[model samples]
Target: MEIMNNDAVRNVVNDVSDQLRRALFQAREVNAANYIHVVLDPNHPVAPFDSLHPDHLEQRVPSVKFHRSMRADFQHQPELCPLVVTLYSPGDRGYRDEELLLETVDNAVSRCASVNGSYVCGWIATTLNGEEFARHIAVSSILSHPLSGRKVLPWFEPHRLALIVDRYPSFAWSRLTNISSWWFVDMLQQLRVVSPPEVGRNNIIDARSTLLPLSGRQVSAVWDDQRRIREAKLVAMAMRKAGLSLPEFPEVTLDKVVRQAYENGLYGQQDVVFFAMNCLTLSEDWFLHPVVQAALEALAGTDELTLTDILAGHSDAVLHEIASYESAGSAPK
Candidate 1:
């Protein structure tokens, strides 16, 4: 019941979001079957979907799994259609529907590599549309597919989209709902910076936590002082409105953030896990930065405890590296 209720509310939200997006573009709704399609020229900067033309049927070969639904067939039958979509659903009670989405999704995913949150994958129980429509995000990258002898760099991913969500919620939703190009671009930027699997997993879970409270460090929420000052003022206003004090800090450096998390038990648990595990995801061959590797070496291999331990503490100005990496993993190739 709780899940269902949430779904019902989300449906309303999605619908409202959709309506708002449409208005932003003054977009006309087209032939929406199992998915939401908007009419646009493929060359247009915002086109998100590409369809098969009824004329060139012979050259396209969608796999069997693509047959799970009419929509999948429509997308993969591959003659050439100019229609593109932002959201799609497979609509089968059976897994066949989901399978079709996954299969057909690959067809479209190439466009989503840099997306923000992976197109909000999987059914979050009770959202009627998501339940049947298997949504897949497209991404763009610079990677070469070794097997195909083709450079298969992705253009979008979900983590990339988070910033868009953070910056312009209305624009993000509208474009995601109205124009695939704009939204996909947001996703792509995130994909470019996405941490590796181990890193991503660690980023979300609190591996070292014991009595520590669950914390959500939203790097996404971090902002420049200009924004922060406004935010601080707004927070102060809200607190005054509620007869409470605003969330505060004298500064917003990395050390300040970590210390705040430790003191209030707010941000570090999951982030610590993320930092520890992220070392594995990056390319094995190191680059110029050796801060992380140096730290690990200092902590594990060498010296007496207190001497290096205190030196390595966040406050110590001894070493500097990319904010994401704490210790250098290895020597640069």
Candidate 2:
């Protein structure tokens, strides 16, 4: 996975923080008591808490709690434990503390980037009180597997959390916790939000004893989601290598191109990437052209030619004509 550079990370974090601040103001106006908490993975080299000033650390209002203390196995490994710090409260008089906490989170995320991605997962805003919210998140972190018994689920990690929300049924996830909204920066360096399904809001589980089981099918779905995420990252990297500026919300385009590649039986990494590059370079619907479709069909019937070989064989005039057609069709009449 490509790690975002410092500037890119800072811009994304600022955008996310702005949105979170707006959420806080909106909650205050409605007289709803909400708390914003930043969750830090201690496993990261520069944890969010480490970025905080000594005075900020000593503050009692934005209290810090270890999620691992709620579980036995994680208790001894404090260094590996995840920390949740309350950043904002409805009762706060000013935004100074919240701003400081956001800055610390920004610095933490910028410094924690590895080849895999940033370890600073993100923040959460909820109506539940601080202690209740912490307990609920702790309970949700443990998953029961039939074969392995009980294990910790790093569902707080942005990518893993995204996969869970994308694949698991709303009722299954919503019943496990009482989070109003979750905000996280995705692998694409884009801010994303996950909220409880409206229908499942009132059905939250209240006790730690009611742990959700990790089914085989759900596990498989998560794996599939991970594969798709990897493919999107690959496509993004390819585009960048080619000096192509990414479109806004490029993940949406990347996902479509990757899915189209799979649908056309281009399963090999080279074939899939080649197909995606062409679609991204020309048009997402480029393969739908009659000439392109015929070329794909002919290529599919033969093992002699790869997608790259077949597509690259097209004359410059023919490729240009296809691109022109797409451009014309997309134009306002």
* Top-lDDT candidate index: 2
RMSD, every candidate, angstroms: 20.1, 6.1
lDDT of 2 by residue, 1-333 (tens): 244577876777788667767765764554446667766665554534554533345564545532332543566776566656667667777553655557645753453223344446666666656577666666666666565666666667665666566557552455336555677765445567776655333423344445555567665545455566567667767776666766555545666688788888777777788788777777656777788777778877787777667657789988787775564356553
The clash tally of candidate 2 reads 0
Q: For candidate 1, lDDT tens digit of each residue in 1-333?
A: 011255654454454344334432321222122233222112112323323222222233331112111222235642221223223333432232233333223322333221111332211111113312222111111222233332311122232234434443542332232122222211111111112122232222222222111112322232221222322222223333444422222112222333332332222244232232222233322212355445444545434442224335655343333433333555555
Task: Please give the CA lDDT of all the candidate structures.
Answer: 0.28, 0.61
* CA error at residue 280 for candidate 2, angstroms: 4.2
Q: Which whole-number lDDT from 0 to 100 does residue 207 have in model 1? A: 21
Which portions of model 1 miss their true places by more than 4 Å?
A: 1-20, 23-25, 29-151, 161-181, 184-271, 274-333
User: What lDDT does candidate 2 reach at residue 269?
Assistant: 78
- Model 2 deviation from native, Cα RMSD in Å: 6.1
Off by over 4 Å in 2: 1-15, 28-33, 42-81, 89-100, 104-115, 127-153, 159-176, 186-192, 197-219, 240-253, 267-270, 288-306, 321-333
> Candidate 2, 22: how far from true, in Å?
2.2
